[model samples]
Target chain A: MTATLAIGPYNQSERPALEESFNAHVVADPSEAAGMDPAARSTIKAIAYKGHLPFGGAEMDLFPNLGLVANYGVGYDAIDVDAANARNIRVTNTPDVLNDDVADLAIAMWISQGREMRQAEAWVRDGKWASDGAYRLNRKVSGGKVGIMGMGRIGRDIADRLAAFKTDVHYHARSEKQTPGWTYHADPVALANAVDFLFVALVGGSATEKYVSKEVIAALGKDGVVINISRGSTIDEDALLDALEIGAIAGAGLDVFVGEPDLNPRFLALDNVVLQPHQGSGTVETRAAMAKLQRDNVAAHLAGGDLLTPVN
Target chain B: MTATLAIGPYNQSERPALEESFNAHVVADPSEAAGMDPAARSTIKAIAYKGHLPFGGAEMDLFPNLGLVANYGVGYDAIDVDAANARNIRVTNTPDVLNDDVADLAIAMWISQGREMRQAEAWVRDGKWASDGAYRLNRKVSGGKVGIMGMGRIGRDIADRLAAFKTDVHYHARSEKQTPGWTYHADPVALANAVDFLFVALVGGSATEKYVSKEVIAALGKDGVVINISRGSTIDEDALLDALEIGAIAGAGLDVFVGEPDLNPRFLALDNVVLQPHQGSGTVETRAAMAKLQRDNVAAHLAGGDLLTPVN
Candidate 1:
């Protein structure tokens, strides 16, 4: 009688909660739905999914009775929303709950890049501090101009944190929004030109694919650094790598990358960049909250009520 | 005739300015004074001092005509002010110039420790994210209560930055001063007990030696963390190392340490701490500002005008 199908990898805490709450049929991935009995697969009214693999119209055909896809993370780029809309299926994502964690990571990377936290740690741990007199001085971060590529919830949160550090906030969005004395640029290149740091926080999907193009990255001068907590596809990967390699841009503080967890090998060799493993929202508290929100959406769908955070 | 003697290590930029401004005689250490001709040592009226080696009453007595000790850094714990006062020797420190950089390091460490930034970076670089799955989740940092163990310029700066992150700020100072709705605790132990994080920004000197006593560190329960960007004398090293070893507290984000550059071997072994090589005020812009300030003080002293930032 189970109507819920929990797909993709779930943490220890999440697995138990998913099993107990929904009497869910669990699988490691979306493709494994084919392995389920024909009768059971058709019974799935809602799916609790977490991963970056695609969920398109063909995948939706596997579940004839599928009504909702409740994603466990904030970004639902993996879920083809147009496909879901065409199939009359609802989509829900866990947002706002993860804004603080992502924003914290963005700010952390920004400061770490300027202060050289990784190299500093390595110097201390490897006994270089004892052998060498003092670590080399790097650039100062505070009292600089910063541009946020997106002025969404997560972008605004990062801007607020940087504002405390006395950075001048500028941004480029589709249109101007009300803000406290922050400059807005309609063109991404102009926004990049205006600031010493360009932080990418745009949404994922085709319309915004390669949104941070070569021109935008090139506009950031040799002293400029880029920090990205958004999707990898939002950036022109080759352009970024080229810029980082040749010192076209000063550096990058990246939590996401193209084809990640198997990112560009060039990134591994670079010393100028601060690379994080796409952990913008990877906090115990925030993850649990996201899981709960996803489950709540499934419960609401099963109960024939409206989805809590509906995308379509 | 050269009236100034530049002591300890000076970066390339600082060295030329120090030499040009005062026609200063240079020595690697104060002990090298013994090697100088007696007449030259006696004629040194001002010393542009750097490094953490003590400038006690005995060291002060070496340069018989010494009138001022212009320190390169803000924390003048290395200079024996009481001894300077006894000899009518003035002391000047480059203060306020490096506060933002120090405060930024404190916040950077605070966020880095919580986010497991070191591990996250390693996960990507080592190809573990592809081999294994996602990096393990860590605790959230923002929207929590944070405590400041001092209310000095740097302490206030750190609190202001944390406030923008939506953290409830609580502080310990000699007495409460004007703050933006931050709760004050007169007792250091109470401050430790009240918040999830305690940032030590106390000044260094015998008066505040081991100010963050064993009792105060013990008060921070298992979930609490400590961040120190101040002088190494503020905390008992043995107590901190012991607590870290036994997991008495969660972790520490430390920049300064006792006998730093030659820190306790125990700190290198501990995985719970984010160890930095005492680079709190080591940014290029800030360091240049500090060097300029120190040189300005020396120039003023030589000209028989008011010292820029005199201590005694």
Candidate 2:
């Protein structure tokens, strides 16, 4: 029986790399592990994991000999870290490698939403430019006030990029950071009110679930735009949907949702919102880096070295 | 008779400001001036012009007392400068004010095309994410090589913005510019070949017509993306269409087209392109500034002062 188990529907390009490094057993999800022979499950010492499915103690119990679970993404919200800790199982996630791609997407979405590039493109493709005379003038994005929620590594990266565009950067973090010139808001609602564009860059997990609440969304105002590159759980999706539907907020550029891939159907009808399939770090370069980090963590655990990026 | 003629269809918001500033006669186009009574035509000393219709010596002849043509846009290509010079007419354009908006759009378009953001948006909106799983990974835009075809003010602004993203900024100009640290290629093809993204920001006129020629486009290679915020005539549109059709180049983000407003229908069919209706400088703030600048130039000319932004 293979000592390693790789889970999730990884693509052809990613599969070869995992196969080369480990004698592995591949499964689509945790349910598949339950169906495996008892001896085969007992043999699994490490799990290479991806996807947003919850992996709790029940799944860990199925693999009696499981030692480590290496997550493919920066966010380890789906991995039950507490359960892993209780079971004396180690957990690690790929981080930092995807910061540039996520930051780029956040900035791109902000510009796209502000400039109405999606609708502008459709207007040209539909022959409206010739018949319609001129495309409607949009709002300027640069030199505007920008607020970043959760001044983590990704948040700082986004703020850095926005600073280059000459935007007045504001942020809300757990505590005051040493960032010079950037205004720090103790409250998220205050940060939202102060900015023309608000970017959600908080981490995932229960602590940050619905961190951007109804009050925060409302404070952003009618001229404000929201750009979320963080997990969908960071925002109160119902409040966001209502704000978008009635024009309480000018627009939203969402890369994540509360139940994404299976995101709310209401988002499908919005012309003001630029929707992306939770692809903040879905770039060839970034994904490759993330995969490498995930494998490195697993390799370190197997070789009796420190876990590369431990969560538990 | 009015001292100024505000030509082209001015919006309600803009028309009031012009009327408040000047004793102005508003006409739709050059042909409308021809239809006006001889007294009205002869009385027109300054024309506050907008639109892409040809305004030449023939049009200038109608306004026997015309001293100034204060163009509402930076590109005064539609107004023949030589014709204005032959008739001893001074031409002024609103420049510098619209640079930030245009540069913003160029950067937005480059990021959009490189990330395949249009398709990514549709994939999420059309419920493909749930059915098709994750959207395919796209190319990362930041930290790539970017070429500026013309290193003028707007181009320099674009380079400055791209530099923040850590891109290698290379440029081609008639002569070497004072841009320290940025690579300068004497030849356009060489510049194109050296970059992943090419931005066209040259001034519009016959001298620069087809400046981004077929050779330059080909040299950009298959992984290269072209972003044009300059005038339609700056690029060889036919060659561009062919390259896009055959996948000879990766993609294009075109805000201007040959004979646009009436751009080629072939562009509509291509998924690799992101089309914009030449709204590079079309922003509420920027347009207002442009209108104010145009009015200022005319006011200066009417008061027997030097033209604010004279073309010839």
Q: Which regions of candidate 1 fall more than 4 Å away from where they truly are?
A: none
Among these predicted structures, which one has the highest lDDT? 1
Each model's lDDT:
0.92, 0.90
Docking class of 2: high
Candidate 2 lDDT at A240 equals 94
Per-candidate TM-scores read: 0.98, 0.98
Chain A accuracy of model 2 expressed as TM-score: 0.98
Which residue pairs come into collision in candidate 1? none
| Model 1 interface Cα RMSD in Å | 0.6
Single out the weakest 10-residue window by summed lDDT for candidate 2 chain A: A16-25
Which ten-residue region of model 1 chain B has the weakest summed lDDT? Answer: B29-38
